[model samples]
Target: MNETQRREQLKKIIEESEPISTGVALRYQGETKRVCVYRIPLDFLVYNKYNGRISSRVKAYERLNHELNSENDEDRELIEKLLWESKVERNRKTMEDLVENGQMRHGIVTADGVIIDGNRRASLLNRAYRERDKHKWSPVDVDKCRYFNAIILPQDAGPRDIQQLETTYQMGEDDKLDYNPIEKYLKVRDLTDVGFDIDEIAKMMNESTADIKKWQRTLVLMDEYLETLGYEDMYPMLDRVEDQFLSLSKGLKDWQDRSVLAKANWEYSDADIDDLKVIAFDYIRYEQEGKEFRRICKPGKEGSIFQDRLIWESFRDTHFETMDAIAEESVDEEIAHAHADIDVVDVLRARDSKWKSEISDSFKNNLKYSVRRLDDRMEDAKPKEILKKVRDLLKEIDTEQDSFLNDEGVATLVSEINRMTYRLKRELGQ
Candidate 1:
């Protein structure tokens, strides 16, 4: 058949075949014979998009042929040699050797093509074909090879189908594919199977975990940074930028100020930053797309420490105020009790001597208003009830006031209250 006729016939045959079908044909290249075959869709052709340059079917053939012709002496000696024997053997060998040795190569195919399903023998054949230069090789030998087989699939296979098939193939093999390298290299940290326990994967790659953690924190601040520059989508480009940051920050490890890192113009020039901002904004337009105020405040560890200390002091002062309120309430109740008991004179004497002497200036000032109110209440109450109220107020003061005061202050307050209580009791003959 003419070349055009042959192509037409191949297409027709492919159309007529079932969803997953196979066929074998011969094609003559000048005086050479070529084994042309249709493989079922069940076969897979794995190719790395970043690296593979060959067309899909051709790449698949090359990969398969390379495997068949592998020079590893041990692979050449498998005894079972069943239909799937080579594939099973290869998987075992790959698991035991390639995986542990980390010699496996990864690549993606840009096109869809026929692939051998877990057939190591077929892979070996394909590998051999790949090793032979197309211009120098004869197809007659391939046609003569009875062990070669192919499974064909429809051209319009869905991605889901391909993924399902790939997963099946992976499961059939004993060797586990190590996706960690790509994942780790892309992100400095990855959460383990367990929740919250983030594994510092970059550390496994000989990177510093602390630095990686710092970078992760930086990532959290990326949105803010991007906002400051009117940028967006800083996530996808994180890997590249992080590397740049690492290089820039390497010498500045001792610098606790993040501003130093932020100010340091490493790989990104002012112009580049503008350009990157535009690119990021375009890429991540879905998120809030502008510079944020916080992004400009790139504080380092020291800055964070300073901020924390300020907050702590503020909280301490607030707590002290709350404690003062509690103490004043207690003192008021005590004064009112003394007034009702008709022991106002005694109470006044005790308060001037004991309360004034024991409590600090701050505590005394807070108690002043409440003490005045209690003294007023004591004037209108019966003497006996006033005394009881005074005792009760003193006990409440001892319990609640102690919590607000410092340890030494509390001890002094308690001692004074005890002395007053004793003196009052002796005077009342109770």
Candidate 2:
């Protein structure tokens, strides 16, 4: 139904039903008011495409398939699928509860039938209505599932007001815990696009303005990452890497202001920062997180590849070379020629996994060697411990001419060790 038709249906329903308070007061027009709860037919309302649980999912879909029109059958099915898949177990439990108890809490919707709150409940209501016949259910439960119990907003409500109300109900309260962390950052972006400032968004989300600002910046980093991997605007691709982005974002922030650094041997420029971000982006794409990921880009600390200039230069050169060696084997060409049945993100993700699996040994080996150099240089490094490790390694090597000469790298290192030992003996006056 169009907006006017939906509004008219809602108005007629509200006029016929008496307002049930249920002791719930909704803040509207700068005042708190107890609104009437009317049973609106489920067909009159559309699931919110920007619903917090599936906002990024929808965005990612629309990014590739164009904007979704919920009025369309296929699009509606897709939206419902996203909602259901957002939290399948929780949705199942909610569906069960809905079948048994009906809608315990009233939802909020615009006069034009856009749900602002209780989307999950309304969705489950729709599900119960459709699936009622598949299972044993009470007659009243089955009948009640056909309609949604909700408070319809007044006609004066604008888009900004609807967005704000959605934020207040869905994100400013307990329900926020169910939301994906990436949702807030994208929500901030959406809210800002709809004419809300940092302070207004902070107030709506119940976060500090500084937090909103930081999320905005972090969101840009996330966007850049998507664009870098040929997945521009596919926010769902980041579903598993929120922590990686958070850590990388904080490191980038620290990179911007080195005054906060505790100790550093490197003086980096903006170009260096870009390199750091891109390198970290690669690791994030490969799903290397936590301290393992930090060894590549953690800021204001020693031992990280970027924390030391010499280590960074060598690591960067080798990393670039390694990436270039496999660049031709990436899934981009495959994605380009892929049959319509294959998912692009899945292919790219497979590419990342394959890439990590292929290069993990070399990647980790280089990083470990660099970090070992850093450890050796630190003021607290134990010389005897380092020597003992060297001695143990030396004792295990085969010094036979055939075995030693067969391995060129071992032969080179052994020669260098012999020269170093001779110098040490002379220095000790042996």
Candidate 3:
């Protein structure tokens, strides 16, 4: 039989047979790849949004069990209310679409019925069943959802198996959608927190170990920085801005290294962390600007600090005094002071307005310093070696001269060559 016929056969088997009890030594019968449908009671499944104060599936089950067994009426009521609301919010859209189409896909569950996948669907069906009698206001028909559909796994499936299967079902499927950065980061972090080794997670998620570590590190540091700034509760502010946080991470390490190395010490100083805190706050504020901040921090942009490693080095080595503005007592105080005069956006824009000129000036000064040193060396060089070097330099100059399409560019190159030639003659006593 074809696929649809097989599914119909499975549905018939489910309807004719009694519900399979949990903890049974269930074995696969008939074909191994056949889809099996079971009408599981709503209480048998669990909801795990992978967020909130309860961080893991185990924790969610614990709260659920507490609600099921609690002697205190108030505690049970509160937990029940929370579960209902959370499930409704998460599953409402899926429920609406499924009912409208009158079709549902297969969901996976363990024998003990901790939903490995499709908790939202199960939750919606459960809600429909619970409210079936309250027909005066119920949106979903209770008669249609007396039991939830699922493909129950064997009794031996453990947490590792569940995690692996969920990851596969969510990420490995051809129809898989790209998760937003924050969701991806949180999922990886959650897996790590639940005792999955980095290499194991890398293999499971099809990501490099370094990539996994980078996400974890960025998340950990971002949380610490948010907590430092008294906005730990506001961590969702980082959603969709992983690049900014990653850039801050790199910038923080660079700044710390420079500050510590300047003191001739290998350990991080308290002042270094303090400076980092301020910069971290600045970075988050910049991220808040959304598109404008992205424009300034765009990787591979013309004069972006994030794009140009050399710009960061130049700022660190030469323009260190410019960052003194961020060296305040606290991020809060610095932010307040920043906004006390001009708005933060205006302040940032003003700095961006000067960035090109500042970078140009710094570049010219460094070039001038290099030229002076080269002049000193040329003064003492052997004439033959000098002539060979000058000839090679002239060849390079000629190659570049072909690309100088503008009149101003040609004039500048000719003038520079003349100045260089005059210097060479003076040095060689010509």
The model with the greatest TM-score is 2
**In model 2, what lDDT does residue 394 have?**
83
Q: Candidates sorted by lDDT, descending order?
A: 2, 3, 1
Estimate every model's Cα lDDT from 0 to 1: 0.35, 0.81, 0.51
lDDT of 1 by residue, 343-402 (tens): 332443354344334434543343333333333443457768767866676666655555
**Which is the better candidate, 2 or 3, if ranked by TM-score?**
2
Give a tens-digit lDDT track for model 2, residues 90-187.
Answer: 99898888878877888999988989988788888888778877877777878888888888999899988888898898899877988898898888
Better of 2 and 3 by lDDT: 2
Better of 1 and 2 by lDDT: 2
What is the overall TM-score of model 1 with all chains considered together? 0.21
lDDT, residue 71, candidate 1: 29
TM-score for each candidate, following the candidate numbering: 0.21, 0.91, 0.49
Task: Point out the worst 10-residue segment of candidate 1 by lDDT.
Answer: 47-56
Give the Å error, residue 139, model 1. Answer: 10
